[model samples]
Every structure is written in structure tokens, then in C-alpha cells.
Target: MKAVVITSPGGPDVLQLQQVNDPQIKDDEVLIKVAATAVNRADTNQRQGKYPPPKGASEHLGLECSGTIEAVGSRVSRWKIGDQVCALLSGGGYAEKVAVPAAQVFPVPDGISLTDAAAFPEVACTVWSTIFMTSRLSPGESLLVHGGSSGIGTFAIQIAKHLGIRVLITAGSEEKLAACRDLGADVCINYKSEDFVARVKEETDGKGVDVILDCLGASYFQRNLDSLNFDGRLFIIGLMGGAKAEMNLPTLFAKRLTVQAAGLRYRTPENKAAIVKEVEKNVWPAIAAGKVKPIVSKVFPFSVAAEAHKLIESSQHIGKILLVPS
Candidate 1:
């Protein structure tokens, strides 16, 4: 098997494709012949040695992939050999083959290509688990998404809008904001020139949004709190702006706000399976109905994984970037 190897803790240049042993599946897992894998910010962090794979997970870079089932374990019943599926992986999506728990695998939505199905698992599970499952973001409410043009942000906007939630997003550029608007974002704020907290409040009629999905952790923490309505929920998934922050306890007390953070990679397989099930039940329908779609910015062959990483780090791409095995 061939996979992208991180030679050292550094930039995208550290990624190198090389031959490796094919993964062995456990009794409850299945082997996927990778068709495509999506690049994520966490992959970059892992390459830089900032985020290590969870214990017993594949040390490779990819977190999600779409592929054909080459083999299924004895304990796996729902999936069979030759099933075309996409899976939520803990790691090791950057290879020709990966072993994953069968429970985390999903049937590709009707009308979606097998390759593009690679874009859904990570972003879908991340958004669904955090805001909808935990924060309980319901219809007729307003939600704000930070990094509006990102993979997670793009998916979040469409799904939220489909569910009747008013969507507001913050992006750094007008082009990015325009993309968000076309994807159903009702309010778009350019963080480079305007204040998102003020804009969020303004769009919600000064009451603030009912929920906020933030990736810029520390730099936007306090401001996120200020931009939330009373009893609002703020879910943080990444710390791109740094991890440490000083929070005003009074704000939480005054507004009865809830601040929470989580990552999909380190979760127990059982937990991830539950989230995957919910995504299949809720999100897949929207996708099949053409209400939600995969927003792929670019596709790179596995040999050029570093270039894909560079594109993601540059924040120039509007949606998910994919890597396919050559």
C-alpha cells in the first residue's frame, strides 16, 4: 500500500508519498480501497506535529474518505464486499487502503458521485454532532458560523438553511462572503473590515444568534460570547487563533450561555458511530433531495498532497479539497 508520510514536524513539504504495509482489519472493521480522501485543517496540524493521532488510530493524515469495500470483517453485517461507501475515519485516509469500523461507514447518497462522497463524512459529522446534536439548533432560529467559506462552514450553512434556520457567516474576503450568500447564508460579514459580533447582533435584531459555530478559538472567544443571544450555544471545533483566552464569567452568567468544544478524531468508536448514524439519517436525505451539496474547491492527486495542504493553509479555497490515489 502507498500512503502520505509525514517525514518531520514542519510545513506541507514534510508530506511524502511512500510504500507502507496495508492495514489489517479487526473483527468489527472493514478494509476500504480508497477512491478519494479530503484534506482538512487537522491534517495540516498533524503534519506540523501539533495534533497527534489518537491511540491505536492510523498515523496517516486523512480523517475521512470514500472508497469501495474490498473486505469486511466477520462481525460486520450491514456492509458487504464491493459496496461503494464513504466513511468517517479516525486517521489514515491518505492511502490506497484503510481499515475502519463498519459502523462509521455510510452508503453514498443517491445522485452523488462516489469520489465526491469523500467530502461529506468529516464535515457532516462535525457539524451535526456539535451544533445540532449537542447545541440543539432548531428551525426558526438564527445561527452564526465562523470561517464561513470553509468545508465545515459551507456544509453548515446549507444544512441549517434547509432546516429553516437563518444563517449568518463571517469570512475574510468579499469573494468568500459571496460564496456563502449563494449557499444560503442570510448575513455575511467580512471579518477583515467589519466587526462580526456587531454584524451578528445587527442581523438578529440586536438579540444575537441562537447558536454560533466557531473555529478561531481564542481570538474570537469573548467576541463570540458577546454575539450570542440569551441562552445561546457556542460550539468551538478548532483553535486556529490560539488556545488560551480570558473569558468574562459575568457574560456567561448574564446571558446563560453555553460554550463547548470538541473534535471528531479522538472520540470513541461508539460515539463516532452514533454521530455517523444521525448524519446518515438526517443529512443524507437533504443531500439526496438536492437541497445540500458537496462544495469541492479542488482535487489533487496523492502525489501532490503537499500542494493540497498549501491550498488549505492559504485559505484561498472556498470549500473542501480532495486527494485521489494515483
Candidate 2:
């Protein structure tokens, strides 16, 4: 099996493709012949020595993948060999074959192709967990998403709209904002040229939003807090804007706000399995109904994963970027 390995902490140029031993499965895991996996911000961080895989996870870079089951473990009765599936992995989706716990693997949706299914697991779990499960965002409440054109943002917008929630998003360009609007975002603000806090206030008649799905992390921390209404929940998932900031306790107390941060890759297997189960039950039906769909901006062959990394770093794409292992 050929896998993309980081030679050292640096840029995309440091990634190297080399043949490695095939993975062996454990009793509750399955070995998949990977058809495709997608590049994510976490992968770029790992390549730059900023993020490392959780203890006991594969060193190769990839968080989610879609493929066929080449082999199944003894306890895996729900899925069998030859099943078409996609999985949320801790690592190793960059290779031709990877092993994952059976409970974390998902059957591809009824109408989606395998290549596109590769884009589903990570964003689906991330958005569903952060906005719905953790924050408890309900219908009739307003929600704001940072990085509106991103994989998570696009998916979040569609799901919220379908469930009768008003959505507001921030992006860098009009083109991306237009795309977001087409996906059902009720309001789009150009973060480069507008004050999002003020805009959000005007749009909501100064009541603020109930939940915020943020990826910018610390730099936008204060503004995010300001943009919240009473008893708002701030869910931070990415730190693209750096990670150091001072907190204002007075405002936090006044608004009765809740700030929570987490990463899916480092979760316990039981937790990941639970989230996967929720996505399969609550989200997959919407996908099968065409109310939501995978937003793939680009796909590169596994041999050219470095190119995929470069695109992810550039941050110029509208949605998910994928690498297919032929």
C-alpha cells in the first residue's frame, strides 16, 4: 500500500508517497480498500507539525474516507465484506487500505456515488454535533456560521434551512456568499468588508443569534461573544485565526453564554460511534431525499495528494477537496 507521509514539519512539499505495509484489522474493526479520502485543515496542521494524530492512531493524514469493505472483523455483524461504506477515521485514509472500528463506519447514502460520499462523514459529524447536539439549536432560532463557504458551513446551512432555522454566514467574497445564498443562507456578510457583529445585530433586530458555529477561533473570539444573544452557545471547532485571546468575564456572565471547543479526531471510540449513529439516523435521510448533498470543490488522485494539500492551504476553494486512491 502506498501512503502519503510527512517527511518533516513544513509545507505541502514535505509530503511524500511511499509504499507501506497493509493494515491489519482488530476484532471490532474493518479493513477498507479506500476509493477516496478528503483533505482537511487538520491534515494541513499535521503536515506542519502543529497537530498529531491521537494516541494509537495511524500517522498517515486523512480524517474521513469512502470505500468498499475488503475485509471485516469477527464482531462486525452490521456490515460485511463487499459493502460500500464511508468512515470517519482518526487517520490512514490517505492510503490504498485503512482499518477502522465497525461502529464508526457508515453505509453510503442511497443516491450518492462513493467518490462524493467521501466528503460526508467529517463535515456531517462536525456540523451535526456542534450545532445540533452540543449547542441544542432548535427550529425558529437563528444560527450563524463562520467560514460560510467551507465544507462545514455549506452543510450546516442546508441542514438548518431544511429544519426551519434562519441562517447567517460570513465569507470573504461575493462569489462565495452568492453560493452560500443559493444553498439557503438567509444572510451573508463579507467579513473582509463588513462588521459581522453589527450586521448580525441589524439582521436580527438586535436580539443576536442563538448559536454560533465558529472556525476562526481566538481572533474572532470577542466578536463572536458580542454577537451572541442571551444564553447563546458558542461552539469553536477550528483555529484558523490563531488561538490566544483575553476573556471578558463580565460580558460572559451578563449574557449567560456557553463556550465549548472540541476536535472529533481525538474522541473516544464510544463517542465517535455514538455521533456516527446519530448522523446515520438524522442526517442520512435528508441526504437521500436530496434536501442536502455533498459539496465537493475539487478531487485529486492519491498520487497527487500534495496538490490537494496546497489547495487546502490556499483556502481558495468553496467546499471539500478530495484525494482518490485508485
Candidate 3:
């Protein structure tokens, strides 16, 4: 099988497509003949040698993919050969074939194309596990999402709006802000020109949002705390803005806030399986009903995996970018 290989710790140019051994499946895993894989910020980080795949995971770049099941292990019962499915992968989605735990695979939602289904698993599981599952963002509450035009942000806005949550988002440009509004964001603030903390407070009548999903870690940490309501929950999933930050302990004490940081790639298989199950149960219905949809910005063939990485790093695309096997 051909897979994108990171030749060194550097820029997108480091990614090269080359022949590699096809991944082997364990007794509880399935082998997916990759139809499509989505590019993510983490993939770029991995290419730069900042984030390595978890122990025992595939060395390839992709974190999620949609494909046909070519083979299923004896321990896998829910899926069969020839099932069209998308899966949440720990790594290795960049290859033509990947081995994944059967429990992380999902049936493509009705009305969604098999290729587009590749965009859902990672963003869906990330948002669902962090905001809804851990933060307990319920209906009738207000939520703020950073990088509003991103894959995670786009999906978060639609799902939160569908569940009756008022959505506010921060993006870098007017075009990005407009896209977020069209996707059900009630408040769109340009992080480049405006103060998001002030805008968040203004939109919430000075009380602040009930929850905040932030990817810019240290740079936005204090501001994020100031933008949260009493008893607010803040979930940090990425550290794009650097990782070190000094927090004001008084703020936490005064507001009774909760701050947490987690990612899906390093989680135990059982934990990922549980999150995948919850996503299938709660989020899939919204997608099937046409309330939530995949937002694909572009698609690149596997031969141009380097270009896909470049596009994601440029941050010019508004949603997920996909790569199909060449």
C-alpha cells in the first residue's frame, strides 16, 4: 500500500508518498481499504515532530478515515466484509489500508456520501467527548468556540445550535465569520480586530458563556477564564498558541470554573470506543435528519499529501480538507 511518509521533522515538504507494508489487523480490529482521509492540525504537528503517534499506533499522519471493510477480525461481530463505514483512527489514515478497532467504526449516516463521511469521525468525537460529554453543555446554554471556521468549530456550531444552545465563535476574517453565521453561530467575533473576551461577555449580558471550546491554549487561557460565566466549563483540546501559561487562581475560586485538557489520539481503545458509541447514538441522528452536515473545504489526491498539509497549515480553508487514494 502507498502511504504518506514523514521524511524528517520539518514543513509540509517533508511528506512523501511511498510504498509501505499494508497494516495488519488484530483479532478485534478491522482492515479498511481507505476511500478518503481528512487532514487535521495534529497531522501537521506530527509531521513537524511535535506530536508523535501514541505507542503501538500507525506512524502515518491521518487520524480519521472513511472506507470499505475489506476484512474483519474473528472477534468483530457488528461489522462484516464489504460494509461501508467511517472510523475514528489513532493514526495511519493516510495509507490505502489501515487497521482499526471495530468498536471505533461507524455506519455512514443516511444521505451522506461515503467519501464525505471521512470528515465526521474525528471532529464529531472530539467535540462530543469534550464539550457535551465532559463539560455537560446542555440545551438553553451559551457556548463559545475558538477558531470558528475550523473543522471542529464548524461541526460544534451546528450541533450546539441543533441542541438549542446559543453559539458564539471567534474567527480571523470576515469571510470566516460569515461562514460561521451561516452555520448557525449567533455571535461571530473577528479575533484579529476585536476582543473576544469582551464580545463573549457582551453577547451573554456580562455574565459570560456557559461553556468555551478553545484550541489556542496559553495565549487565550486567561482571557478564556474571564469570558466564562460562574460555574462555566472550559475544555482545551489543542495548544496552538503555546503550552505554558500562568493562571490566576483567584479567577477559578471566584467563578467556580472547571478547566480541562484532553485529546482522542492517546486514549485507551476502550475509552475511544465509548466515545464513539455515544457519538453514534446522539450525533448521528442529527446528521441523518439533515440538521448537521459535513463541511468539506477541499479534496486532494494522496499523491499530493504534501499540498494537503500545506493547505491546512495556511489556515485559508474554512472546513475539513480530504485526501483520496491515488
Clashes of each: 0, 0, 0
Please tell me which model should have the higher lDDT, number 1 or number 2.
1
**Candidate 2 structure quality by residue, lDDT tens digits, 1-326:** 99988889998988888889999999999999999999999999999898999998998999999999999889889988899999999999999999999999999998999999999999999988888989999999999999989989899999999899999999999999999999999999999999999999999999899999999898999999999999999999988888998878888999999998988999999999999999999999999999998999999987788899888788789989999974
By TM-score, the better pick of 1 and 2 is 1
Instruction: Please give the RMSD to the true structure for each candidate, in Å.
Output: 0.7, 0.8, 0.7
Candidate 1 residue pairs in backbone clash? none
Point out where model 3 deviates above 4 Å: none
User: Candidate 2: worst 10 consecutive residues by lDDT?
Assistant: 301-310
Count: clashes, candidate 1 = 0
lDDT of 3 by residue, 39-86 (tens): 999999999998999999999999999999999998999999999999
Model 1 scores worst on lDDT over the 10 consecutive residues at: 196-205
Tens digits of per-residue lDDT for model 1 on 104-135? 99999999999999999999999999999999
- After superposition, the stretches of candidate 2 with alpha carbons farther than 4 Å from their true spots are none
For candidate 1, give the lDDT of residue 227. 97
Question: Which candidate order results from sorting by lDDT in descending order?
Answer: 3, 1, 2
